[model samples]
Target: MLASLITFFLIGLVALVVLGVVLAIVGAVFSAVLGLAGFVLFKVVPVVLLGYVIVRFLAPKEKRLAQMERKLLETD
Candidate 1:
């Protein structure tokens, strides 16, 4: 009976270790996904948006003049 109990205990310990390894793997995958999302949200999106704004600002003078005139008319 004592030998059977020890066998059962070792089996249980092995099961727990397997569960822990699976959880760690899943957590690492989620961490990688979140890291990529954060990089796009915090870094890539802002750079793209800033570049868009800069392009608009550097557009043709005639287009800017039209926008300025429109703004003036809207304020009146």
Candidate 2:
């Protein structure tokens, strides 16, 4: 009976250890995913938006300049 009790205790301890390891792994994965999401939100997204704004700001001026050049050439 004592042996059986000891065996049950060891099994419980092992189960607890396994559960702790699983939780640690899950926590690490969650942390890594959050870090990546934060990097994209803070770093990548702003750069892309800035590039988009710069392009939008320049495009209309470029089209106007192109139209003026065409008119000048046609007059010649």
Using lDDT, give the best candidate's number. Answer: 1
What tens-digit string does per-residue lDDT give for candidate 1 at 1-76? 9999999999999999999999999999999999999999999999999999999889999999999999999999
Q: Quick one: best TM-score, which candidate?
A: 2
**What would the TM-scores of all predictions be?**
0.63, 0.75
Question: How high is the CA lDDT of each candidate model?
Answer: 0.98, 0.96
Model 1 misplaced regions, further than 4 Å: 56-76
Candidate 2, residues 1-76: lDDT per residue as tens digits? 9999999999999999999999999999999999999999999999999999998777888797898899999999
Off by over 4 Å in 2: 61-76
TM-score of 1: 0.63
Residue 26 in model 2: lDDT: 100
In candidate 1, list every pair of residues with a backbone clash: none
What shift in Å separates residue 75 of candidate 1 from its native position after superposition? 34
